[model samples]
Target: MVRSGAGESMRQPVRREERDRGEAAGGGNRSGGLVGWRPRVLEHKVRPADLRAVGEVRRELRQLLSRWREPAGEDLTEIATLLTSELVTNALVHAKGGALVRATVTDRLRVEVRDFAARRPEPRAATADGTSGRGLMLVCSLADAWGVRSHAVGKSVWFELGGGPA
Candidate 1:
């Protein structure tokens, strides 16, 4: 089957479950959203040089949860936001190329940043006077689980908040 058609516009690929939920929630092509899915997934391109993208990622995450009408507590949202900022900021500063932030809400909340950097990130030894090098440490302490995966052209840094099945 072809991915496009006459008078048809190309669209982002979305999971099946997302399509149903988005339609049911009035967030799909039938209404407002182009593709609505529960455990809503959203991604945005980032310029590591721009420090502001971090907050923008966080804000978008908040808006997503709100749109889903998830009963997620503020605490959940806050932690998710903070961790997202750290990961995205790290990617922009270190990834050495364009980055993308993806927020996935399944049974739990997860935020991941993908960058074109091949090196894996590790928490550096922190000294009392150090002003940097604590991002991953915070993720470890707060997230239920977090880790990185290497890609041929880059890597993705991710963290999960709260508990839920995979």
Candidate 2:
């Protein structure tokens, strides 16, 4: 049995022994690790009305993902951060009530910002004057794909990363 640096069993011999016994009974080798499983899911929920709270949420997300895997060559962290900021910003600026921000990482990372607003976000052309209306454009530029989905209460703006699960 190998213990981790933290002094916890890295792999339980009892489980392995049970598997070996089962395999011996059935005529097979049971030396391999757990046969079948899926990656764990990580989730976060935040209220979009509080900008600072949203930023902190984003920061926490970055730290968590960073510990799991090195950021892909693509600027995924930056893209995700920008995408979250833009979606949450839009929710706060345009929606009636506060918004819900949900982030999940599985085979890929997905961020959804939901708000009680039926209004569709318009794609704004950058004007020479340069004052307002470019958040969605930034989101479009950064995300692999993004769009708005309507719910009974309001809508959810969601984006996905191109790489494998975070």
TM-score of every candidate relative to the true structure: 0.72, 0.66
Clashes of 1: 4
Candidate 1 per-residue lDDT over residues 1-166, each given as its tens digit: 2357676767776654455588768744532343454367889998758888777778898897776545678888888888888888888777678698888775567677899978899988678898778889888878887778777889888887756522
- Candidate 1 Cα deviation (angstroms), residue 48: 3.4
| Cα lDDT, model 1, residue 99 | 92
Window of ten residues with lowest summed lDDT in model 1: 29-38
Q: After superposition, how far is residue 100 of candidate 1 from its true place, in Å?
A: 0.8
Candidate 1 local Cα displacement, residue 83, angstroms: 0.6
Question: What overall lDDT goes with each candidate model?
Answer: 0.76, 0.68
lDDT of 2 by residue, 82-111 (tens): 778888878887886877777765445667
Which numbered prediction scores highest in TM-score against the true structure? 1
Task: Work out how many backbone clashes candidate 2 has.
Answer: 1
Cα displacement (angstroms), candidate 1, residue 116, comes to 0.7
Clash pairs, candidate 1, are 18-37, 22-36, 39-105, 48-92
